[model samples]
Target: MKEILPRQIESLMNILGTIPGIGAKTAERISFHIITSKDNMVQKLIDVLYDIKENIKICSECGMISDTDPCHICLSPERNREILCVVEKPTDVITIEKTGEYNGLYHVLWGVISPLEGIGPSDINISKLIERIRNLGIKEVFFALDPDSEGETTMAFIASKLRDIEGLNITTIARGIPLGGNIEYSDMYTLSRAIRFRTRLNDNL
Candidate 1:
């Protein structure tokens, strides 16, 4: 077998490594797999990648990825139009949907506001969210952000903005030590539950 050139493999590995969670070793494995795959399979993969680049676009109304402007969720009549769930990414939308607990629409922010990362309201789609709330007459907004410091800060900012909006309700998920957590490693379920079930911020403290 002829030896593969270091520069050739290295160039491909570098680009693949740029993807989140894909390191050099994994990239090399994937590159080898792709190069050794059948011609049809490799051609199909290449075609799909190019098609996604050419066709995928953000939904104008909800910021979800879609081939069309509004996306299926925004256009679906079965969805509850009055309720809106705000999530940090499109993947979060899938996670929540899997729970089968929510029947509302979604607004994917694409990311959270993080000062350390130089991200702000403008960096995401908060302005478009505000417009959607007002124009679509959304009655309730659920903040389904991750359970982290930045998520908390983002929720606070959004709540403050919607506080005075009449006929609109803002809510967040309940918190507890996770379902399968050991008390030893757990931060504090009592504290977490206290925060989750608290009637107000002061009550929790």
Candidate 2:
């Protein structure tokens, strides 16, 4: 087919298509929408992106992306400080929070351990998690990682490390989530059930 789209529009479509779940057709539509809109949406988007880039800060304690060092959850006195929920990313934290099933503090690993991908325990936030649990005197720690192989591996590894901690309970979310499902994509009811019926890792491992 002859080149119908302008060079800049084509480039924009290509860039947008690179985003996950966005196909070429969807990217083309979005690009046309951006270029044709008269509400100065593009400029507003640019401004928001720039503001996010400049102002976003990772939580020093939990590795969550927020505007504060410790993040609101970490600073919230209403949360259960004795219990910590370990998740893969900051988005996972948000997902669990929406369910209202967990009111404990969170520790975002940022990513899970994937040996195939050359990501080990050190690459993510495991060390800090261990230290945080000990320092905070956490009594129970439950993993909310995805149900994939990597998520399992990461959870098992962290559970083993915490084994030596005296009187600490290590658990994983129940199998309410499908074998390969992601925590972030799970329905609120399912995720709530998973957390509510979490099983002790010691019993399985």
| Top model number, lDDT | 2
Best by TM-score: 2
The TM-score of predicted model 2 comes to 0.93
**Candidate 2 lDDT by residue in tens digits, 1-205:** 2198789889998999999999988998899899999999899989999999998999999999998878999999999999999999989988998998899999999999999999999999999999999999999998999989999899989988888889998888996899999888889999999999998887676
lDDT at position 38, candidate 2: 98
**Predicted structure 1, TM vs. truth:** 0.82
